[model samples]
Target: MKQSGNSKQFAKKDGEACPRGRPREFDTDTVLTSASQVFWNHGYHATSIDDLCKATGLLRGSLYGVFGDKHGIMLAALDHYAEGSVARLAERLNAPVPAEEALRNALLHYARVACALTGERSCFITNTTLEMQPGDEELRTRVAAIQRRMATLLAASVIRGQASGAFNSTLDEKAVGDFLLCVMQGLRVLGRVAHKEDALIGIVDVAMRALV
Candidate 1:
């Protein structure tokens, strides 16, 4: 993720016709990655400006100047996370394998990641919705859109599996896709509490049983 710029320098000479002063030397992608982790670990309301400043290694003035506000930085981080997530989903769904198996693998991978021993840094999108839903209309809308994109990918996989006789053709593909999306989000919540590995695996196995 190379940030485009003719210069990587930030500390410029004063009154040199450079109005923005220093011009932000750090990579935008790098800042978002670090900031996203802070927000993911600490809820949206819990994270403070000072927290972001420390996480991104930017002064308060620089962060505010670059991002406008905490909300702006958060919005960018959320978009970045959701984009990466959906792209990964697309890659898994487009794998050179049985559609049904690929779908199962995708679900299992999320489950494993969610249920990992040090699962504090869960999906930022999921964490956002859980933390800010019902009140944060902007973020709620964004998360819903992201979920729809996820559901669309899952439904395509389901449709493919049905066409190949790998899934139950009688079931409505969209319903099944939405169901899987709901289950995966539930798994993320359960991931925070479930201590045993078999418990998470069993939940995933049963969730996949819907594909029959």
Candidate 2:
């Protein structure tokens, strides 16, 4: 029998504490990513300070020192998520292909991710929108801004489709973008319980018909 086993020492010990004597020395973006995941899995109100501290591997004091508070970290995480999502959307919507094709690619990408793994997670923004109270100004603004950006990006693609004669020219680009945005969000929500691929594909087809 061959004795081939990798050493477990290379892995950071699970209970290992953060290195002390170095303030703001850790990766901020990485912390935000970890913090975002905890918040995404559990809404802001439900997620405790201890939850974030454990997720980010930082002490409670350090977290407050760096991020001001839990809400601060949540905002940073939301910003990080929004920025990354918009960048990805721009890439997909701006692909060098027919507008309709690009839109299909984007929608398919969303569908694939939605159905991936357990498919229990929906978009963070969508979840936050429902969880946060309407009086939450900062949260509302961030989500609204992200939605607006998505609409604009999709509308740009719609315009291209119209110009290429691949999509209906008479349809309002912004309106179409809004419709597709709704479809995209709905698809994500529906994917949680839906296992069949064709069901989601059919939804895509129906949504695409608006453009055609």
> What is the per-residue lDDT of model 1 for residues 32-141, given as tens digits with 9 covering 90 to 100?
98899999988788899899988987666556656778998998899888888999999998899998789888888778887783556667887788778576787778
Give the best candidate by lDDT.
1
The TM-score obtained by model 2 is 0.85
| Residues 1-212 of candidate 2: C-alpha lDDT, one tens digit per residue | 11111122212322333344222346777888898899889879889999998898766666665567788889889998888889998999889887888899899887876777355357787778778887889888888899999999999999998999999889998898898888888778777677666888888888888677
**Total colliding residue pairs, candidate 1:** 1
Best by TM-score: 1
What candidate 2 gets wrong by more than 4 Å, as runs, is 1-22, 117-119
Worst 10 residues of 1 by lDDT: 6-15
TM-score of each: 0.86, 0.85
- Model 2: weakest 10-residue lDDT segment is 1-10
